[model samples]
Target: MFISLNVKFDLFYSILAPNVIPDGFVDGRQVTEKLLEATQLDKNLYQCGNTKVFFKAGTLAHLEDLRDDKLNGIISLFQAEIRGYLMRKQYKKLQDQRVALTLMQRNIRKYLVLRNWPWWRLYTKVKPMLNIARQEEEMKKAAEELAKLKEEFEKLEKLKKELEEQNVTVLQQKNDLFLQLQTEQDSLADAEEKISKLVLQRGDMEQRIKELEERLADEEDQAANLNEVKKKMSSEIEELKKDVEDLESSLQKAEQEKQTKDNQIRTLQAEMAQQDETIGKLNKDKKNLEEQNKRTQEALQAEEDKVNHLNKLKAKLESTLDEVSLWTKWIFFNIFHSLL
Candidate 1:
């Protein structure tokens, strides 16, 4: 009797999956580690060494079974892809065969059933020419429609170009308007600053006017005091005149009894003249103060007018700024709406 023995090789190497090993990797220990890490196999079944792996008695068998399953799964995936492609090819062939068979059946039925009829035979003989004429007419109509479509397309293209140009112009205008708005805003800020400065100046002017008025009041008080002093001097002059008259009467009655009487009279007259000169100077000073007060009032009036003018100017500028802002808003709204 002859006996044949079949032996399977590689109990340990078979456990490494083909997909786990990189190209040019030949080290057994690295391959074992990669396979173990990739597969996450139970550590109790195998031990890793410096250059080899030791497996328990049944571990090699189990790993080989797992490798076989993985290989089978890859084979099955390839088989499914090939089978799907073949099935699609076969389905297309079957569809063509079915259409050809249907066409042949229709032709056989027509030949067997209608071949003997005179009208059918005549129609068959004339059908090609009639079909040709009809196709020619349809072709003519199609050509006319195509020409019309070409003309319409050209018109649409021209219109699109014109619209694009208009849009560009509108965008340019919008940019110009935006720049104008920015300039207006800058001007408005400057105007506000000027107005603020004017307001502060107005306050200063008012304060100065107030100070002038107070000074004028003080001058009036000093003039009243001078008038009182003048009145006291006039009373003393009247008393001195009366005393001179009495002394003259006594000199006449005593006839040269008081020889110094003439000297006292002369002194009294000189004092009167000095008092008159002082009165004249006081009147001139009062006139000067009156003129100064008048000038001060005129200056205050001018300042008030200046303040009024500045207020009017500020209002006008504010109105203009408001109008510009409104116009800018309108332009922005219109531009945005048209773009949308």
Candidate 2:
């Protein structure tokens, strides 16, 4: 078998070319020793025709040349070695891709499943609370508006009542003035008839005429006092007219205020209704967000369970690899001793 190995040694030598041969390999101990020594010098080396050669790490040129050999055994080993190296390289690439993919998958899964979990909870709980706060603010504003409207309405009502009361008072004063004017005119006519009767009596007696003259002077003084009273009444009538005009102006102002208050109440009622509708919509949206939060929670739980299961599988795989390594070492030791 060793001589047959030398038959196509040139092919192997080229494939397993050594960069530096070891100092003590001039006399070979065994095939395995020579192979081990050649590998130590250059791990890419392969054996053929009692020599070693190196091939590039990923090239198949040497293996292709060896395939032309008619002997199946020699060709088989060369093919096996090339296939093993390629398989190992391919496996390593797959492992790297798997590791990268696993990390990427884990990160993607985490973000997809867990990243929004807290955000969902915040949206569910905090959004509703914010909505409630906003609704409360709106309610407060509505209440303030209602209060302002009611206050203005009350003020306008009070002012209107006051104006009506003032108008009634002015009318009463005018009626009193008319009654006083009638009484004054009746007194003036009675005084005129009494003075004419006094004049006729004065001509009847000389002594009586002297007394009558003094009485006439007293009557003239009373007429002068009446004229002064009439002048004062005329000034009072003018002052009452001014008061009536002022009352009319106040009545107009009160009516305008009442109209403004009515408008304000209408506006407040409209705004309050709008706020109620907005609050209802916000409440509905809050409910929907809460349902979404529940679904997110369930999804996060499922992802956590999957990650835990994967961790267990990875631990089991590591344990199996350890066992395989120990078995391989035992087999290698046995084979080495048997060869010795």
Candidate 1 error regions (>4 Å)? 1-127, 223-340
Candidate no. 1 TM-score: 0.30
Candidate 2 per-residue C-alpha lDDT over 115-210 given as tens digits, one digit per residue, 9 for 90 to 100:
468666444433343344454555465555555555655555555555555555554554454344334334544544554554444333334435
Winning candidate number (lDDT): 1
Residue-wise C-alpha lDDT for candidate 1, range 223-327, written one tens digit per residue:
876666555555655565565555445435443322344444344445445545554555555565555555555555554555555556546555655665676
Ten-residue stretch with the least lDDT total in model 1: 1-10
The Cα error of candidate 1 at residue 121, in Å, is 13
Worst 10 residues of 2 by lDDT: 20-29
Per-candidate clashes, comma-separated: 0, 9
Which stretches of model 2 miss by more than 4 angstroms? 1-227, 324-340
Candidate 1, residue 91: lDDT: 100
